[model samples]
Target: MFSDNREQLSRSSTFKLLLYFLACIGMIYTVFVHQVYLSSDTFHRKQLDRELSQETEIFTALAGIGNIDAIRTLIAEKQSIASPFTYHIQPISTQTASLSYPAALTGDQPYFELSDLKSGSSLLLDDDTILRIEINRDLLQKYREDLAPMMISGVALPVIVMIAGAVWFAVNIIQKLQRVNFAMNRVLCGEKNVKLAVSRNDDEFDILSIHLNFMIEQIEKKEASLKALTVGVAHDLRTPMARMKLRIESLLALTSNNQQQQELEACHDDLELLLGMFNGLLEIANLNSGKQLISKQRVDLTTVAQDAVDFLQPLAEEKQQQLILRQDAAHQLDGEPSLLFRAVINLIENAIKYTPEEGRIVVVIDAFGIVVIDNGEGISDLDKLQVCEPMYRADKSRSQSGSGLGLSLVDAVMKRHGGELVLRDNSPGLRARLYFN
Candidate 1:
């Protein structure tokens, strides 16, 4: 069986355009060479005709002087020069003027002999003498040989210059594209305000930079507006919710029936949950808005990981799960200790909540980051992307009792410290990795 061996070619516009330009130059060179050949052929034919005419004038004048042998001698001398013409002289053989002519003039030779002039020229001399001259075909070959230097100078050199110019233009465009790509990548890597540098020339790349800067500006504006709206809404709602919680507690104190007391207690619990959700929203908003400043210092990740494990050990034991710490080396990173601690706590808590009873949770600290893993039902592939989004929880963890904003807050803290929180499968479990840079 034969295989389909198709592959994608380069999609760069600069490369494609350069290829097209070279093809055009090739076609133009073909046409130019054809025209040059035609011109050179005409020029050579004209030179041959002039040479024949000069020889004829000299032979006629010499014959007019009534010295036939002298004319023959002159023809022999002219033949010594490097010329395509060959001359022949024949004596009169008949008394009749026409009868004494060469066989070519007597209609004994084919018309092509005269038409192509390959059989030489024939001149009628005094005393019924005939003189014949023929042009050598090698002269045509010589014309072609002489054309090489002319074509190189007139055509090939210019084409080479044109191709070089096209290559330089393509390289310039590619460099501009590379700069644009670098700027976009920097923006993607958490530099929200970064934009392409614009020049005053207003060329295509400059125009592109202007557009990109405008787009980033609009995005930053919209993001700020959304954060402001979220914080405002959470703050406005929390006041009334707090008053409602106080009223419910007061009601619980005044209630006589045990049923009413239970209802008041449930109401208070609901209020507390709502208040906690609002607080989480506010915390994330402040972090995003750059209002939650971090006090960064050199902190050992091993200590942080160990402390988080120790703090959550009691909860892990209550569920009959193993909380273990594995440190390879003492790794230090510039970060806010309180924020990093909170992130570690969230990871460990999430691991404990998802892992089955008596499951093993491992906190591993390495040279670059900390990884909290558990031998539990890991998150599905579909939920991994949305895990950091606020209020996003895996289906298996939906039944557990906790706010879904734990990982979301942890993600915010990591970003605030210029780090990343990665969630992935640990083959048989989930691995939550925090990379500090």
Candidate 2:
């Protein structure tokens, strides 16, 4: 069966976060264990010293009394302690001995001792039983066995707590990130209004969610713009193209020579204007469509601007328009060389077309981007949206200057680079900025 059965088994962001927490917990656990071992070792050593101290006190007190029966009485009356130890007294003046030990020791009654515990267990004193009360180290062996479990529990409990705490924190953060992930996935599934349900905080994730949502909003705007372009392109392309065909046929039917010549010239102008409009539409369509792949490469913006200015000088001079190229900053961009040049040229051309004769037009690069400014009557804000539609002109009757496809081409080029071309009004003219990110 064609199924993604294991897909869900793959770790969620939650699981991954939990795993990371577990890893950190594991590291902390190792350190805790080391400290526990060190503590246990130190405690066990102190316990051994404690056993020897009690033995010394008891043995000394008995020797001071100097009576065999008194030593027996002391052993019988002494209370048992947490540390494992045994007391055995032997009269050494004669060759007689006695032994006693706790039930925890290993022997017939789980304990064993020699009459002279001094000689039976020699690990500690090394046969130095002369003129001193002697003791055995069987007590020390039992001490380790008694304290082992308590020491293990001390280290184990904290490890459990550390892991639990790590898991708790991991689960909380993972839940937040998962919400954002789902929101984005919903957007891809045609859910336009989906939003990351992030709580208000100044954390890095919160900042990321904000920026990501902002980007989604921008993408929504561009998608809407492209949808509107279809209707706009159809309307703009049909009108003048329809007019040219009608105007030409009628002019061809005229018989008077001078009148025919004048009519024919008008017809030629309309056809030329129609052709220019189609060419601009074609340029924009090719750029936006998947059909024409741009041969993109790194390009020096300085050289590109200079070339565009040089190429447009003659056209600018024809209309007594001055094309001023100003470089405020150097830009290195990546795109098809020809397309970039054409887009920039169209921008300059649009400015030249709208500005009055001998009016100033400036083309400059800046930190913001490349800008084309002109001292012409600027477009109103309401009409700016209509400007990028192929062959769209607000004042369609006045066809003395623009075929109205210049801005359309510029918009397409900018959109392809994940950038924008904004037509903002200068106080007395139009200011166009082309941003390349």
Instruction: List, residue by residue over 110-141, the lDDT tens digit for candidate 2.
Output: 22222233222311111212123333356555
Candidate 1 residue lDDT tens string, 93-198: 6323523343433333212122124335566664445676667667767777788777766777777777777756766676787789888888665577787888
Could you tell me every candidate's TM-score relative to the true structure?
0.77, 0.42
RMSD in Å for all candidates: 6.6, 15.2
Residue 190 of model 1 has an lDDT of: 51
Q: How accurate is candidate 1 locally (lDDT)?
A: 0.79
Candidate number of the best lDDT? 1
Q: How far off is residue 356 in model 1, in Å?
A: 5.7
- What's the lDDT for residue 30 in model 1? 67
Off by over 4 Å in 1: 1-9, 53-66, 79-81, 87-116, 122-132, 136-139, 152-155, 256-258, 288-290, 293-300, 313-322, 332-337, 354-360, 375-404, 415-418, 423-425
